[model samples]
Target: MNTIEKQKLSVLIITLNEELYIKSLLKDLDFADEIIVIDSYSNDKTTAIVESFKNVKLIQNTFEDFTTQRNFALEKASNNWILFIDADEKLSPELKSEIINTINNPNPASAYLVYRTFMFKNTKLRFSGWQTDKIFRLFDKLKCKYTTEKLVHEKLEIKGEIAVLKNKLIHYSYTNFDDYKAKMKRYGMLKAREKFKKGHQPSFIMMLLHPIYTFLYQFIIRLGFLDHTNGIIICYLNAYSVFIRYKELKKITSSRI
Candidate 1:
């Protein structure tokens, strides 16, 4: 009897009270050889749901900056081939096939940039500065890891060759208008804290201009206006987030002084 070996893939996902979406995402990652979830002691049924899945291995750690949490996940991954995805992100059938083929190739890139389609409450955002959204998802664990010292947007440092995949990874991050606003505010707060750590002083000129520039950049320059009301709403929210970040930064700086 001859058996063909399948390429080993270890999927890593970081979570925090993601009971609402993680179960469905875990189901989609069933094809992976191993699925490791680094949860931040979620006070929800997220762990319960994950435990129900036979293939998933759940580990709890206290919540911290995004980079620290993601790096922790990377340390827990067993296989060298890693596919890092969020609880709100999922792979389409075509993307799943492509990833399998890529992993099986003898000479694949050290890491790959996967395009992400942003969805806002069931609407696919074709604009609002999200059209070119991409991230390094699939990669060789030995060759790549998170590097940027940010508390919000964790960036990966990749070594050797990099390539882009054809299929887009679906992102169901924001569920509704309120959900978007809540997330924006939280991200803004985290970003402000990161800036404060870097000794970024509060500037009145930046406070006034950054948000305005952000609105213009998103709405006018990025063609977000063409996406109509949805785009308009996101652009406004994005600008508001910038305002919130500066506002929080001022508070943090004042308290320190």
Candidate 2:
């Protein structure tokens, strides 16, 4: 479908120090009628790269919770149809075409879930829980909004019907193990903070069992071994993240007591 025939779409993105990936993502989003970037005052060239895009409107907001930042971006959207994508993620050509078709057709659903394929260190992981990583990113602003339940792993709340897309969103999450580990640490800390805010008290058993279960569930149950070395590393890293999160939670809870 051509641009004129398709419903107007606003592509919303929240970024913080995403200079390395913002340019490429902006390039891929040229098909959208409007691109709204709500940046958290990235100290790098992220703002500059976003400013270069004519279709994109750059808005700087203080770093807050993910849900708040995303909802703020949604309000700035002129189109009712909103596609919220991360800075590290790019829409595949197939997915882009599918989105256009879906918008043009205007289904009764309020939101669409898109599967994501992760790339780590130049390897596209097909297994190891990554294959099952699908998120509801494309939605109608009037019918959907992000939930404020969790700080790190926030979810979209849809008031109406939902549909799933076939094509995958390409996610270039980490360039190397070091980068991945850094992200895991940050996420772990954020998760711990979220748990603390919810008055969650971590026990020794949870700190021990959660990581073990995480490793076994992903590496064995989820067939992480199928992806070979990368899968193993990812599973181990995920377990480590769980362990760190619980440990941090314990420390925070202890200090409070």
Candidate 3:
């Protein structure tokens, strides 16, 4: 066992009915000094499971945009060093060790980006544009914050230099096809709402070609065909998600006009 130098690190997570993956995620996060979960009133065993952990603190809030929920979590954290992780994500042993070492030895950078390896139905995906998946997860709360521009795919904005970690974060993104479709639909709606609010007008060209282009780019250009059935399904669903978003945007625009 490696004796890591103690560092005050707060692990922050935002959840909404994520009972399936919450327990396992929390278990792997035992190394954190405090685990703060900002839930959107999940009517499931999510809260109960989190309560089982001694170091975890759960706060229930109404469902809002991703940026708002994440920023709220940041304010609730006691420590300066914050690691924002989703319920479906678990820290690999290598990542855990790397995080501990990084925090112990202070760096001039305000945040660190970690790569993620996505799993679909328990199979790790190597292609389909998932190989280069990375996000800024670990950061100093005072120096970094999520941008409010994107309602669905919110990204952290750092004030100073950004460092990259070597190890990958394990992400169990989808259990089955149904789960994947459901999330894509939900995200599409959220993205459409954001665009509508920004006064984006839907064009017939975009509605017609965007989905087709998206499918071809991911499946053919990105080598999504390498994953076989999983790749095809994911690429098709992704294209479907784009179509749904634009369709909803058109509806909203038509109603306004």
lDDT of 2 by residue, 178-229 (tens): 8788888778887898899888899899999999999999998899999888
Please report the TM-score between candidate 2 and the true structure. 0.92
As for model 1, its CA RMSD to the true structure in angstroms is 2.1
lDDT of 1 by residue, 199-237 (tens): 899888998999999999999999999889989899988
Where does the lowest 10-residue lDDT sum fall in candidate 3?
Answer: 100-109
lDDT of every model, 2 decimals? 0.90, 0.88, 0.88
C-alpha lDDT of candidate 3 relative to the true structure: 0.88
Cα lDDT of model 3 by residue, 7-33, tens digit: 689999999889999998998887899
Query: By summed lDDT, which 10 consecutive residues of candidate 1 come out lowest?
Result: 2-11
* Alpha-carbon shift of residue 181 in model 1 (angstroms): 1.3
- Choose the strongest candidate by lDDT: 1
Superior by TM-score: candidate 1 or candidate 2: 1
Candidate 3 residue pairs in clash (backbone atoms < 3 Å) = none
Q: Write down the TM-score of every candidate.
A: 0.94, 0.92, 0.94
